[model samples]
Structures are given as C-alpha cells and as structure tokens.
Target chain A: MQLVTPGIGLLFWMTITFSIVLFLLSKFAWKPILNSIKEREDSINGALSAAEDARKAMDALKSDNQKLLNEARAERDRMLKEASEMKDQIIAKATKDAKEVGDKLITSAKDAIEKEKLNAINELKTQVAVLSVDMAEKILRKKMEDRTQQEAFVNDNLKSITLN
Target chain B: MFSNKYKITKYLIPAFLVVLYVTYAGLKLANAQHEVHTDSTAIVTGTETGATTHSEVSHEESATEHKPEKVDAGKLIMEHIGDSYDWHIVTIGHTHVSIPLPLIIKDDKGLHVFLSNKFHHGHEAYEGYELKEGKLINLSGADFLDLSITKNVFAMFVAVIVLLIIMLSIAGSYKSNALKAPKGIQAFVEPLIIFIRDEVAKPSIGKQYNRFMPFLLTIFFFIFINNIFGLIPLFPGGANVTGNIAVTMVLAAFTFVITMINGNKNYWSHIFMPPGVPGWLLPLMIPIEIIGVLNKPIVLTIRLFANITAGHIIILGFFSLIFIFAEMNTGLGFGVSAFSVAFTTFMSFLELLVAFLQAYVFTLLSAIYFGSAVEEHHHEEHH
Candidate 1:
C-alpha cells in the first residue's frame, strides 16, 4: 500500500523544486544555449555563400584573362604579316632600281665607244692623204735629174687629163 | 564490417553462455523457493484475514510458531521501494547505521520540528508522533500534515542541485563560446540537446517546440538525473525518487496542465464536435474524448512510476532470494547467493537502460501531447 501511495509531502516539494528549475533554466540556460546555436548556424551559412560568390568571381576573371590573351595574339599575328609584306615590297623595289641603273650604264658606255671609233677613222684618212702627197713629190724630184724625161712625163699626164 | 561482426560474435558466445548458466541457476532456485513459499503464504494469508473465522485459528497458530524462521520477502521489498525519513546505509549485526533526516509536522496543537533519529529506529515515540511501519502517526489520533524531508525529497533536492550546477555550467560555456565549435563537456552535452531538439521536440511539437523547450528539457534532465542517481546503491544514490508515485504524479500534472493551457480552438472542437463523425454519434464520442483527455496524463504518471518502481523491485527481489533460501539451510543459502548476486548485477544493468528509456519516453509522450494540443486544422469543412 505504501508503494502505491502518493505522499503529499513529496508532491509539494517536487512542485516547488521543478518550478524553480524550469524558471531558472529558461531564463539563463536555454536562452543562451539556443541563441548561440542559431548564431553559429547563421555564420556557417554566410561563410558558405561567401565562398560560392568568390568561386564565381574567379571563373569570370579567368574568362576575361583568356579573352585578353586571344586579342593580343591576333594583334601580334597581324603585325607580323604586315612586317613580312613590307620586307617583300622593299626587296622587289631595290631589285628593279638596280636593273635600271645597270641598263643605263651599258647604253652610255656603248655610245662613247661608237663616238671614239668615228673620230679614229677620220684621223686615219687625213694621215693617209698627207703621206701619198709627199711620196709623189719625192718621185718627181728624182725624175727631173734628167730634164727631158721630166717634160715628156708632164705632157703625157696633161694629155690623159684632156682626154678624160 | 564482416570482420567486426565475427569479432562481436566471438565475444558474444561467452556472454551468451553466462546468461544461459545464470538462467538455469535462477530456475533451480525458483523451484526451491516455490516449495518453501507455499507453506509461508498460508501463514501470511491467515494473518491478513484475522477477522475471518474459517482458517485463521489453525494458520494463525502455525504463523506464530513459524515466525522465527520465516522471511518476509514482501515486507523487505516494500521497505526498499517505499519512502522513509532516514537514509539506511548499512547493517552490522544488531546495529543499523543510517543518516537521520529532518521531520516537520503541523498538528492541531502546533508545529513540531525535529530530527528523525529521535525515533531510535522506530522503537520509540518522539514529540507526540510515533514512527509506525515507516509512517508518522499522531499519538492522540490528531490529524497532522507530514512535511518531513523524506528520503525521496532529499534525493530530489540533491537531483535539483546537480541539475542546476551542470546546466548552469553548460549555459556558461555557451555564452563564452557562442558560434564556436564545442569543447569539453559542451561537446558531450550538445549532441544530446540537439537530439532532443531534432528527434523529440521538433518532430513531436513542431514549430512551437521553442516555447516548450525549457520545460521539456528541465523534466528530461530532472527525471534522467534522478533515475541515474537512484541506481547508485549508495548514499545519494539509493533513494527511489523517480519511482515514488507522488513524484511521478507531479511531473505528469505539469504536462497535463501545459497541454490543457496550450490546447487550441481546433483541439477543443475536435473533442466536442469531432469532425467527420455522424451527428448521432456525438453523444458517445464526446464522453470518450473527455475520458481520453484525462487518460493521457494518468497514463504518463503510471508509466513512469511503474517502470522505475518495477526495476527497483526486481533488483530487490533478486537480493532477497539469498535470505529466503538461508532461512531454510546454511549450505543452501550459500549456494543460492552466488546466483542471486549474479542476477542482481544483470538486473542493475537492465535498470540503467530503463532509467534513460523511461525519461526519454516521458519527454517524447509529453511532446506528442503538446503537438496534438497546439496543432492547427487546415482541412476544415466549409459547412
């Protein structure tokens, strides 16, 4: 019977003790404990979202760098092509100028050689006429040592001239 | 994992053998006790029905003759589980060593306060109140209120103090390390708090669980701590605080009051009108609902009280077996004691599990009741 009985004294004490426990714990213990838990959860979420944003920003920056590199490469390729074209054009112009100068030199040298050849031919003709006259004079003086032979020679030449 | 299972079975085989051995020994002892118990029951029944004429004459005469040898197992079990004014520690020969507690009573004459030790172990009367069969009886047949610090109440004070210290420290740690990873006792206690929150409070009571968390946690740790302390079997441990019917009644009352106070309009309507039921059935349903409402808290009270008390009785019963057999013969007593001690140890372990389990069950059921009380009706009929 005692085992099943509910003692009034115990019930009274239990009510008082349990009420105090509930009141104190609710004010001091549960309030701080639960608040800290919620705060920790919020911080964790903030850190995760921040990490996600950083990763996205890195991806965007990586794409931007790739675009800049591609543009630089294209510019380099155009500059290289223009430099090669200019080199080819300069080489062709130099070669053509050199050929024209060589042709002018050859023509001028050919003209000087023709003028010298004509001058030399005129001089040679004049010298050959002077020598023929001196030779004729010398042959006449030698024939006049005999006066009669000289007179007959002159008359024969005159007669041949009158007949012509 | 397979290796681990095999290892577990390796250890399990020996433990299983031990259990089998203990059970066999227990059955043998039971058979022996049963034989002696029949004769004793006849004498005990005779004493119980002294007013009746039939078998009392013969049995009463036999009971008086056999009183020296007979062991009262029922009395021993009751004394252990029942509340007392003094804390019994040990017994040596003819002397009982115990810690006397305070006794306060208010009678017709005036208030009387004294130490329980003045009773001289219930052999004498002190201050007009005689300690009779573990109860204080007024000498002049006057009505008085006993507000003594009985064993259960003292144990509750100890339990409350321990609860306060541990809980306050945990709260302090939370304040110092807010939003930081838990450390020390915080690490150990945090998970249990979260488990009650997620598994018990949230699922059972839903969103309004926050409002009830303080009360829920207080009762959970209060009962759990007291239950654990009750298992200690020493000073500060042996008081069956949670097993006391009065204590459990108060705890259940708290839940009942909370539920009634928090019950919403929908809760009341469902009990009074009971949606989806035919109008003719209203008469039967409403009374049933009212009975069901009252039954919930009563069930909670009995469930906790019975579990804790039953555990104490089983342990005490196994312990009482040695004395029961000893009263028969010395050698039989020695032989029975080995099995008695072994079974008592096993029961103690089982009680430890029961201690936590009962606390959890009480809290969970309370949360479920709260959930039902505050639940909203989203499917109301247009009519």
Candidate 2:
C-alpha cells in the first residue's frame, strides 16, 4: 500500500486518456451546453422585447390620459364661458323688459291723472254754475219778497225791453 | 501574424513542461539531501517532534560531489533537460561527440560532449552542480532543459491537443450543423464554449468579447482539461502540471501582461492616483495602489500554485503513509499500506473536484482582472 511514486508510464497514459475524453466531450457535450446557452439567450431577448413593448404601451397610455385630461379641462372652460355669456344675455333681456313695462305703466298713469283732473274741473264748473243759478233764483225770490223793489226792477226791465 | 500567435500559445505547454522538469529535478536533488518532501530517511518514527524529518527524504537523489556551478547558459540549459534530451555537443568526434551514444539513463546526468581523453574509448558524461548567488541558488543554465517530462506534462499536452481537435471539430459542426443529432462530447463542450462567450467574456469585457473569446475559451479548456487529466492515475493524469508553481506563475504573468496592455486610462489612474480620493491622501493611496497592482498577480500565482501543489502533495503523502507504517513494523506496514491505498484513492476522487474548482477560480479571477483593467472608473462617461 506504499504510495507508488506515480510512474512516468502512468502519467503518459493518463494524458492520452483524458485528452481523448476531453476531445470527445468537447465534441458532444459542449454543443448541447452551448445550445442551451443560446436557448437561454433567445429567451432573454424575447423577455427584453416584451419589456420594450410594455414600456411603450405604458407611455402611450400616459399620453392618452394627459390628452383626455386636457380635453376635460377645455370642455370645463367652454362651459363656464357659455354660462357667463347666457347669464349676461338673460340679465340684459330682463332689464330691457323691465324698462319697457315701466314706460307703459307711466304713460297709463299720466293719462289716468289727466282724465281725472279734466272730470274734476268739469264737475266743479257744473256745480259752480248750478250754485250760481240757484243763487240767482234765491236773489230773485228775495227781490220778489220785497214786492215794491221787485215790481220796480221788473217794470224797469220791461221798459228796457219795450224800448229795444 | 497567425504564426506569431501560435508561437505565443505554444509556449504555454512548453512552460508547463519546463516547470515539471525543474520540479522533478529539484525533487531528485533534494532527495540526496533527504528533505524536499515528507517521506524520507530523515524523518523520525512517530508523528512527534522529529517524526517529520524521515518523511522529508523520500524523493529521488542523484549521486553528486557538491561543486559550485559555473554560470554558463549552456550548462544551465543542460541541467533540467528531460530524458528525451540529447544535444550534440561535438559533431566531428568520430564516435558521436566523444560521448557514448545513448550514454546514460534519463535520470542519470551524462555529458553531451564527451572528450576522447576523459572516458572509456571516446565517451564522457554530463556534469551538474547547484548554481548559487548571494542569498540565492539556481541550477546552472545548462541543466535547465526539460529534464523530467512528468506525466502531468503529457496529460496537459494531450489535453491541449484534444481540446483543440474537439473545439475545432465542434466549431465545424456548429458552423455546418454536421451531426444530424450530435451527442456526448459535443453536448458537453459546446455549452462551455458558448458559456465562455456569453457568460465569461461578454458581461465582463462587453459585446466586443468576440476577439477575447478565443483566449478565454483556450484558457478555460486548458485549465479544465489539465485538471481532469491530472485526476486520471494511469498516464496523463500523474504529471501534476497544474501543481507546479512555475507553470501557475507564467499563467498569472500572461494575465497580468494582457490586463496591463488592455487597460485604459481609468485602470492606470486607479493605480497611480485613485479617483474620489483626497489630495492629501493621494500620497499614501498611490503607493498602496501601486502595491495592489503587483499583489493581484502574486495572489493569482499563489492561489493556483498552492491549491494544485497541495492536492498533489496530499495525495502522495497519503500513499506514503503505507510505506512509513510498513517501514516501522511489518504488521503495521501491511495494514497501513492497504489502508493508505484506499484512503489515497478516495482523496484522488476528491481531488477531481478541486482540480476543476481551482481551474474555475483561476479563470474567474483572470476574468475579473481583465474586467477591472478595462473598467471605466470615471464619472464623465455616465452623462
């Protein structure tokens, strides 16, 4: 069992054997291993491609979202503008309508006041005329009550009439 | 241009071989002194105070006269030359350079240029001695040739060639879809190739990793294949190429060089004057950063060298237990040797994992180093 100084003969043969084995292994074993590596590479490329597509999609989605947001903002702005404009128009229309109605009421009121005043003046004149007539009658009756003055005034008036 | 690149790559294995030769020679030389490893006559009996000494003398020792080596390049190269080495020192000596043809055994040191007057009828042998310097010792340059081509080297070579053939062949298959239904080796190796490209190179080095892919792939395969090759006990596996420190050092050096060359202004700035650091602290930070630059490769070298070396040593040590116990007593030897084999085999099984794990760790670290060097450590680029 003493450890043999590994013989030169042993060394020579071992070299040959391993060389053949390595050569053979290189021929057969390495090819498949490389294929597997290439396969791994292909898979990696595929993964990278997928990742690229995903990133692009994400970017597209983000821009689209921004566009939509901008559109929403614009629509909101337009609506606000329209509401303000409509409010102004409505206010202007209401004010004009109120002025027109006020003018009609004032004209009607002025006519009514003038008609009442004319009626009042006519009625006063009638009353004054009637009172004057009544007063005259009363004065005549009073003069008649004074028979002598009344006869003389009557005779004077008849004489003045005969002469005309 | 291709050839230059190939030339660079050719050195990687040669570098491994060179280290193997050196380690083997060092082991042999240490064996004479009885103390490179743990299983030698110098070690004592028990696992006590002096028990470890006997274990140290188990390595092979060559007969020597202890001469200080002359520092000649030729001599340095000659020392570590492997069994296969046979340099013609003298051509016109009439009988193979005055030295006997096939003069000595692989392990025995023999002179390449034998002088007619020196030995038996125009034959002489090589000489060797330890090269020494002030506080340092190296073998003369002559002995530095591939002295011991261990099994690890063979296995590593085969692993490399095999890896090449497999890769080239599979690459053909991939390009052509050759196998209608490929199985076995193709299946295993192809994935790794792809993994190296997509996983290792791309993420760290970026999409421009194509140019760098081949190197990374080569390194991964080289380390992985050798590690596995080391595991096999019969032939190629025993070389322990990864275990050698010199080999790992060179590998780390390659990384360091590549990283430096590829590094941008950003990388260099971090080393010389780190960014975001206060002006007052720049003096301190700069030195530390400079030190860190050197530390990276050193850490890399030690991590690999130690891990691989540890595995080999442990396995060998386990096997040695049988001899140690048997040497102590006949009964103990019988029982312990049997136990040691089984234990060693189990350890070898575990070593396979370590082999791969270490290779992975080394590769990962190398990749990290590359990444750091190329990384843009400035804020201006962010905008």
Candidate 3:
C-alpha cells in the first residue's frame, strides 16, 4: 500500500523546489547559455561570409592586375613596333635625300666641265686664225722688198688659187 | 548489415532466449518456493516455542534469534524499489547503518518537524508518533500529513544540487568564453542538450521549441540523473527517486499542465468535433477523446515508474536467489551465488541503457504532446 501511494509532503516539496529550480535556471542559466550559443553561431556565420567576401575581392583584384599587365604588355609592343617603323622610315628618307643631293652635285659639275671644254675649243680656234695672219704678213713684207719676187709670189698665189 | 532473413533470425533468437530464460527462472522460483515454505514452517514452529519460553530468555537472545529471519524475495525486492524514511546503506552482522532524514508532518496540533531517528528505526514511538511500515503514524489515529523529506526526496535534493552545479558551471563558461568552443562538462552536456533540442524538441514541438526548451531540458536531465543515481547501490545513489510514483506523477503532471495550457483551439476542436467523424458518434467520440487526453499523461507516469522499478526488482530478484538457495542448502547457495551475481551484474548493465532510454522517451513524448497541442490545422476539400 505504501509503494503505490503518493505523499502530499513530497509533492508539495517537489512543486516548490522544482519551480524554484526552473525559475532560477531559466533566468540565470538557460537564457544566457542559449543566447551565447546563438551569438556564437551568428558570429561564425558572419566570419564565414566575411571570408567569402574577402576571397571574392581578392579574385577581382587578381583579375584586374592581370588585365592591367596585359594592357601594359600590349602598349609596350605597340610603342616598340611604332618606334621601329619610324626609325626605318627616318633612315630610308635620309638615304633618299642624300642620294638626290649627291646626284645634283655630280650633274652640275659635269655641266660645268662641258661648258669649259667648249669655251677652250672656241678660244684655241680664234688664236690659231690670228697667228696664221701674222705669219702671212711678215712673209709678204720680206718678199715685197724685191719687186720681182713680190710679183712672182702674187702671181704664183693667184695661179695656185685658180688651179685649186 | 542484416538482410531480411537475418533480421528475422535476430529478433527470433532473442525472443527464444527470453522464453527459455523465463521458463528456467519459473522452475527455479517454484522449487525455491517449495523449500521456502518448509523452512518458514520450521521457523514459525521454532518461534512459537521460543515465544512461549520468552519469559526465561533475555531480550538479547530473542533479538539474536530474530536477526537472521527467513528471507522473503518479494518483500526484499519491493523494499528495494520503494521509498523509505531513512537512507539504508548496508547491513553487516547484526548492525544496520543508515542515514536518518528529517521528518515533517502536519496534524491537528499543526506542523511538527524532527529527525526521523527519533523513531529509532521503527523500534519505538516518539512524541506520540511511531514509524509503521515506513510511514509515520499518530498513535491517536488522527489524520495527518506525512510531509517528511523521505529517502527519495532527499535523493532528489542531491540530484537538484548536482544539476545546479553542473548546469551553472556550464552556463558560467558560456558567459566567460562566449566565442570559444565548448570544453569539459560543457562539451559533455552540450551534445545532450543539442540532441534534446534538435532530435526531441525541434522535431516534435516544431518552431515553438524555444518556449519549451527550459522545461524540456530540466525534466530530461533531472529524470536522467535520477535514473542513473538510482542504479548505484551506494549511499548517494541508492534512493529510488525516479522509480517513485509521486515523482513521476509530478513530472507527468507538469507535462499535462503545460499541454493543456498551450493547447490551441484546433486541438480542442479535434477532440470534440473530430473532423470526418459521423454525426451520430459525437457523444461516444467526445468522452473517448477526453479520456485520450487524460490517458496520455497517465501512461507517461506509469511507464517511467514501472520501467525503473522493474529494473531494480529484477536485479534484486537475482540477488535474492542466492539467499533463498543458501537457506535450503549451504553448498547449493555457494553454487547459486555464482550465477546470481553474474545475472545481477548483467541486469545492472542493462539498467544503465534503460535509464538513458527512459529519460529520452519521456522527454520525447512530452515534446510530442506539446507539438500536438499547438499544431495548426488546414482545411482540405475531399471530393
């Protein structure tokens, strides 16, 4: 009979004691503990998402760096190509100008030499005519001192001219 | 991995083993009973003559003769499972060592409080009150309230203090190191709390689990600790706190109160109107539904009380076998003790599993009831 029976005293004690325990625990223990767990979970999630954002930023930065490096390399290649082409054009233009100047000088010098040769030929012809006249005059004056000889010379010159 | 056939065999083998064990125990108990009957008759005859010659014999002689009296297995087991006014630790030779608890009672004279040792372990009365079969009775036969903190109640206090220490410390750690990982007792207890939350509360009580978490956790750990403590045969642990119907009744009552308080209109509607039921069956259905509501907590109370008490009884039963055999024949007692101790040890280990399992079941069921109470209903058209 005692085994199955319930005592009021224990029940009263249990109600009061358990209620106190539940109240104290809920206030001091459970609320704080549950809050901290939630806090830790939120913080962990925050950290994970932050790390993800950082990784994404790093990826973006890396891609931007790669794009910048490619652009720089392309710019360098374009500048180098342009500079080389300009250098070849400059050298070719300078060589063509130098050849034209040398041709002009040689042609002008030839024209001047031709003109001097013609002049010298003309001068020698005139000097030859003058010298021939003087020699003829001296020969005539010496011959004419003897009348007969002079006449003979003139008659001979005329006969020779008629024969020619 | 158990294939279909193997699974069948698995269950079948255990069932067969249980049948075999029960049959064997029945035979042994029957034989032991026959022997006990003869032995009790002899004791009764001997005591009758001894009582007649009591005038010449000293009181000490009578006490010594009554000391090693016949061992009644049922009484022994019941005593082990039942509550007591004192915490009985052990008995050696003719001496008994136990811790007396405070006795508080209420009567016409008002509330009276004193040490239970005043009764001298049921030997004599004190201040008009005498201990009778573990209850304090007034000699005047007046109605009184036995509100004394008995063995079970004292054990509960011990359990409460232990729970406070463990939980407060864990709570303190959460406060001090809010961001750090759980360690020590926190680590050990956190998983169990999480299990009750995720496995028991969340799934059963759904989104409103937070409202019931404190109560659920309190009862879970409280019952679990008491159950484990009940298994230990030592001073701090021997009190059958959880096995007591009064404790389980209070626990089940709490669940009942919370359930009824939290029960929504839908819950009541389902009980009274009961959707899809024929109109003619209203009266029958309503009473049954009300009974159903009351039955849930009643079942909860009895289930926990019986399971724990039964486990204690089985183990004690095994222990009594040796004593029963020894009273029949000394050599036979020695031989039976080997088997008795083995079975008792095995049962104790099984009880360890049952302790945790019963706690889980109780919490789970309470959460389920809470879930049902607050569950939402949806109307659907059926063609």
Candidate 4:
C-alpha cells in the first residue's frame, strides 16, 4: 500500500532536483549543441549552392570561348578568299600590260621596215635615170664626129627633111 | 536412417553438454540462495534483540517481529521493488552489507536529521521515530515530514551524476569539433538526441520546439537512464526510481506545469468553449475538456510507474516460483528452478526493451501535450 502511495518529501526533492538539472543543461549544454548542428547544416548548404553557381559559370564561359573560336575561323576564311582575289587581279593586270607593250613594239618595227623599203625604191629610180642619161650622151657624141660635120649633117638633115 | 548408431551419438553429445551446463548453473544458484538465507537469519536474530531493547516503550511492538522461514515470495518481491531507508547490496553469512543514507524529518518539535543506520534496517527506533512497514513514523502518533534520502533518492543522485558526465562530455565534443562529424560517446548519443528532436519534439511541438526542447530532452534521458539502471539488479542498479509513483508524479507534474505555463489563449479557449461545438453542449464539454487537461498528466504518471513496476513484479514472480516449489519438494524445487531461471531471464530481457519503450512513450506524450498547449488555431479562409 505504501509503495503505491506518493510521498511529499520525494516529490519535493524530485521537483527541485529535476528543475535544477533542466536549468543547468538548458543553459550550458543544449544551446551550444543545437547551434553547432544548425551551423554545420547551413555551411553545407552554402557550399553546395556555391559549387552549383561555379559550374554554371564554367558552362557559360565554355560557350563564350566556342563563339569566339567560330568567329576567328570565319575571319580567317574571308581573309584567305580576299587575298586570292587580289592575287588574280594583279596577275591579270600584269599580263594585259605586257601584251599592249608587245603589240606597240611590233607596229613600230613594221613602220620602220615600210619607210626603209620606200627610200630604197626612190634611190633605185634615181640611179636608173642617171645611167640612162649617161648612155644617151655618149651615143650622141659618137655620131657627131666634128662640129662642122654635125652642123652640115644638121643642115643637110634639115634640108633633106624640108625638101622631102 | 543409414547409420542409426552415428545419428544417436550426434544428438546425444549436445544433449549431454546442455545437461551438464544446466546442472552447474543450478548448483551455483542454490549455493548463493543458501548463503543468503543463513546470513539473513543471523542478522534478523541479532537485530531482533537490539530492536526489543531500544523500542520496548514503543506502541508498535510487532514491527520488528518478522522472521526468516521458508521464502515468502510476496514479501521478498515487495522488498526488492519497494524503496528503503538504506541501499542493501548483498548478504554473506550473517553479514548484511548496505549503504546508510541520511534520514531527514520535519516535525512540530523541529527538524531531525541523522543517518538511517541508527534505525538498523527498521529494526530499532532512533529518537522516538521508527520505521513502520517502510514508513518513518513517530511513537507519539504525530504527523511529520520525511525528507530523508532513501534508496531511490540515492540512486537518483547517482543517475544524475552519470547523466551530467555523459551529456557534458558530448556537449564538449560538439563545441570542439563543431564542423567535424560526431565521435565516441557523441556518436552514440547524438542519434538518440536527434531522434527525440526530429521525431518527438519537432512533430509534436511544431515550430516552437526550441523552447520546450531542453525540458523534453532532460526528462527523456533522465527516465531512460533510470529505467536502464533499474533493470541491472546490481549495486547502483535495482533502485526502482521510475517505478515509484512519487518520482513519476513529480515528472508528470513538471510536464503539467510547463504545459499550463506555456498554454496560449487558444488552448484555454478550446478547453472552456470548444470551437465548432453547439452552444448547448458547452456546459458538458467545458468540464470534460478541463478534466482532459488534468487527465493527461495523471495518465503519464501512472503509465510510467505501472509499466516499470509491473515488469519488476513479473520478473520477481518467476524467481519466487523456485522457492515456492522448493518448499514443497527438494527435487521439485530443483526441477522448477531450471524453468524459473529461464523465464526470469527472458522477462529481464523483455524488461530491457520495455524500459526504453516506456521512456520514449512518456517523452512523446509530453511533447504532444506541449504541442497542444502552444498550438495556434488558424481560422480557415473560406474560398
């Protein structure tokens, strides 16, 4: 019967002792313990999100690098195409200038040859006229042996011609 | 079936070994019991004379008349489970070894404080106050306060010291290794602490769990350690602290006080004028709700006390069967002891499980009560 009954003294002691323990533990122990746990959890979460942000930044940087590389390749291709076009233009201009200079030289050479042929024909005509004049003079001198004979022959021929 | 001779020996060898083991254990137990009986008889006789001489003038003369005979199972079990003025450890051949605690009493005359040994195991009276059936009473039939440190109190002090050491060390680890993971005792206890916090405290106490966490944690560990200690049945153990109604009542009272102190307007309103109930039902519902508040703590008190006490009783009952059978026949007693010991061992293991379970139940229920007290009644917004 006494076992089931509650004693006031025991109750008093229990209340005092339990209250003291609760007060002591709550102040000294529980505060630090719970705070540390929460702190750890917060740090873990921060680290995780920071890592995620870093990964996204890396991805964006990779894409930016890829875009730059593609632009550089396009620029190189355009420069190569322009350089080849300039090379063709320079070669064509050189060829056309050389053809014009060659054609002028040929025309000048033809004109010189035509002028020399005309001069040569003119000299040959002069020389042939001189020779024919000389030959006529000689034949006439031989036929009139003496001046008197020549006069008489002239008179005689004239007279004959008149009489005839 | 092939070889019957070989099969017979195979089963027979293990059976022979088991029989040998049982016999050895039974002999040891019988020897110990014999020693206890002889020792207890001598002490009883010596104390009987001392008590008669000192308390000859007292009214209760038959208080010290108990004698050692064949075992009285009921008396023995009661003595084991009940609180005492001193901590009895063992008896060895007429010598009873016990630790005497201080007995403090407040009466009309004044406060009287002395060692409990002066009463000599409730055999002799010390300064007109004698123990009558485990109660310290005055010979003059006057009322007084007994604030003595009994066996349960002493056990509680030991338990408190152990709790302080374990918890403080764990707290230190948490401080030093703040970012690192828990280790050692911290590793062991952190999970249980988290369990109470997450499962018990958070779910029941909701958002304001932090306020009540300290109280809940204290009660949970205190009850749990004491329960585990009571199951040990050795020195520093077997003090039925949680089994005592007074101890459980105090624990329950703490919960009751906290709940009432922390009770919000919603809590009181719900008790006095319950929402959603008809106006006419107020008269009946109000008192019932009020009783419901008081009943929660009372139930908490009785639940812990009864569960622990009942477990101790069942274990002791199994132990008593051996003596009861021994008195009938020597061989019968020996035969019964085998079963008795087996059953008692099984019960003790079961009690271990029950100890933790009861502690959990008590903490969970207390958390639920605090939850209700601080629960906010949010009005539903009609769509």
Cα TM-score per model = 0.73, 0.47, 0.73, 0.73
DockQ for each numbered candidate: 0.58, 0.01, 0.46, 0.45
Q: List, residue by residue over B1-383, the lDDT tens digit for candidate 2.
A: 99985885587557645644654454344344444344434544443323333322221111122212322433322221211112233435235442122322132354333222333331332343221210011235342222233323444556667666776676566545542444667678766666667667778776455445544555677777776776665533455566555556556776788788888898887777666777899889988888888898889878876676667667666666655554433344455555566567768878878877787777777777788888765466433
- The sequence of per-residue lDDT tens digits that candidate 1 reaches over residues A1-164 is 67778998888888988899999988988888878877888899998889999999998898888888988898999889999888888888888888888888888888888878777777777777777777777776777779788789888888889964
Best by lDDT: 1
Best by DockQ: 1
Docking class of 3: acceptable
What residue runs in model 1 are displaced by over 4 Å at the alpha carbon? A63-164, B1-70, B329-331
Q: Candidate 3: DockQ?
A: 0.46
Report the C-alpha lDDT of model 3 over B294-367, residue by residue, as the tens digit.
Answer: 99999999999999998988888888998776554444456667667757776898999999999999999999
lDDT of 2 by residue, A1-164 (tens): 10212333334444444445444554464544455556656777888999999999999999999999999999999999999999999999999999899988989989998999999999999999999999999988877897799889999989889964
- After TM-score superposition, what is the CA distance of residue B14 in candidate 1 from its true location, in Å? 8.9
* lDDT, model 3, position B190: 85
Estimate candidate 2's alpha-carbon lDDT, on a 0 to 1 scale. 0.58
What 10-residue stretch in candidate 1 chain B is worst by lDDT? B46-55
Docking class of 1: medium
True contacts kept of each: 0.85, 0.00, 0.67, 0.63
Model 4, A58-162: lDDT tens per residue? 998999899899889989999999899988988888888888888888888888888888888888888777877787778768878779889987998898787
CAPRI classification of candidate 2: incorrect
